[model samples]
Target: MSDLTFENVTVRYGTRRRGLTAVDGADLTVPAGTVVGLVGESGSGKSTLARAAVGLTPVTGGRILLGGDPVHRIGGGGNPRPLQMVFQDPYSSLDPRMTIGDSIAEAVPRRVVRGSVARRAEVTRLLELVHLPTDGADRYPAELSGGQRQRVALARALAGRPEVVIADEITSALDVSIQGTVLNLVQDLRRQIGLSMLFISHNLAVVRYVSDIIAVMYLGRIVEYGSVDEVLGDPQHPYTRELLAAAPRPGGALLAVPDDDPALLAVADTEPADPHHPPPGCRFHPRCPVGPLVHPDRQVCLTSEPSATPHRHRAACHFAATTDSATLP
Candidate 1:
């Protein structure tokens, strides 16, 4: 079992420019062999958090531990192959001119594996593991369909024998038909390999299907998180409630709404009030529907940052102390 933990992790960009805190002090645990869904709308820092997990982006603050060992510290002569990332765009991730086999082989260190024939055999095995045709080893990425290319990308990530896979918006670009196949394949891989994953997406329906636990991000912070069934079936955060209301439902009818004031749209469009220089209290109060109900105390939500304390379910809102899931729309 491989466990991945992020403790108060923060990722910020820029020097002179107002450094955008892409990920706030977010904390999460992907228990050994469990898949955690990190869901949020565009620019909510879902992808940024995933990149930090894989060391693709430097973490400005906090720690990322794999099985209790620090990720950044593991490069000092330890095998850092336990964590890997499968990106959102399969086409751009792959080299257009390279054969699929060669691409997969590139993942391994040159000292550990060498020679073209040996590499070809390894690539073929990986393709089979990802349920792709061995003939695909000879084709370039463009020659395959979107699903096939994604399979190739998975094969490449798996080739390293990674225990945890961070898939960042991986299926968002595929056709609905192809998306299911890729999701199923990932589910199959997890069961077979005992792989723990951080599946990032803005699509709530897809996240619900793929994750065991769900973490909802807004702006740069995780506003709500819990077991998938608990959080989705009975979301408590005002932001979580709003997000679900906006999501399309199966019967073509909108879900119950907490508030319908169009004024909220204007707040949503503006830049997430800077996290570093966030408004004097609850970072979310500016757009919170219940802001007025808890106005004075809501000042804490705007001025002082809220901590993510565990509850039957957890939400960062100031009124979280008084709000009931049964009361949510």
Candidate 2:
């Protein structure tokens, strides 16, 4: 079993003038054999954090540990087999020129399957493991369907025998029907292989179906973290409430109307008031619907930054300390 832990991980890109903090002091733990969902809107840094976990992106600060051994220590090297990633674009991730068999074979260590015949057999077995036809190995990536390409990507990731697989929006590109099939395959793989997964997606419904625990990220930080039932069924943070409200429900009713006002949307996208540059308090005050009720001292909320604290589950908003009910409407 492999346990993945992120201790105050922070990832920043570019220089100060053009720099952005994609992930901000985030902390999460994925115990072996459980699926943990990282859910958020675009630009929320879910994918950024996923890349960092697999050594694809540099971690600007903090540590990523796998089974008590650090993989992304500031000055240390990474462990290859413990953490692996499946990207969002299956088509682009796989080589267009390379045959699917060759791609999967490349992921296998040369020392383990030295001969061509041995590697081919291992590749054939991997294809079957991922539910692809063994003969599909002869086809190039361009010849496969979108779902098939994704399965090939999964096969490649599995070739290394990783304990932790970070799947970043792996189903987003496929059709709805195909998405369900792919998701089921992932769930089945987890049960059969005892794999720990960090599933990142913007789709709440899909996350609910695939995840045991969910962490909601906003503007590079996690606003709430808890079991899927606790967070999605009964969201605690104001942002989370709004997100649920905006999501489409089963009865064909929209959760909530998205803010269409150009000016407000622009303001929402603008860089938040800096913790150091702002007045005294919460960073979410500007766009927070419940800000007035939650923080009567509006000045403080408009000025100071809030820290993550335990509530019914865990939340980073000031109201988290006082509110007991999970607002689901």
The top-ranked prediction according to TM-score is 1
After best superposition, candidate 2 residue 218: deviation in angstroms? 1.0
lDDT of 1: 0.79
lDDT of 2 at 8: 88
Highest lDDT: give the candidate number: 2
Q: What count of clashes does model 1 give?
A: 8
**Candidate 2 lDDT trough over 10 residues, lowest sum:** 72-81
Report the C-alpha lDDT of model 2 over 1-329, residue by residue, as the tens digit.
77889888999888867788888888888888999999988877899999888888899998899877886442222223667789999889999999999899888866566799998999998988889999778899889999999999999998877778899999999999899988998888988888789999999999999999999887777889899998877777777776786688888786543478342364456554453233345555666655653345555566557777755478888666554343345
Q: List where candidate 1 sits over 4 angstroms from the true fold.
A: 75-80, 109-119, 258-277, 293-297, 324-329
User: Model 2: runs farther than 4 Å from truth?
Assistant: 72-80, 256-280, 293-298, 321-329
TM-score of each prediction: 0.88, 0.87
- Model 1 over residues 1-329: C-alpha lDDT tens digits? 66899988989998737577888788888888889999877778888898888778999999999888897665323233777889988879899999998899988545545787887888888888889989867889899998899889998988776768899989988999999999999889877887789999888889988889999897778888899988888886777877787788878766654465443554455455555566655677776766643344445565577776667467887676554446333
How far residue 211's Cα lies from its native spot in candidate 1, in Å, is 0.4
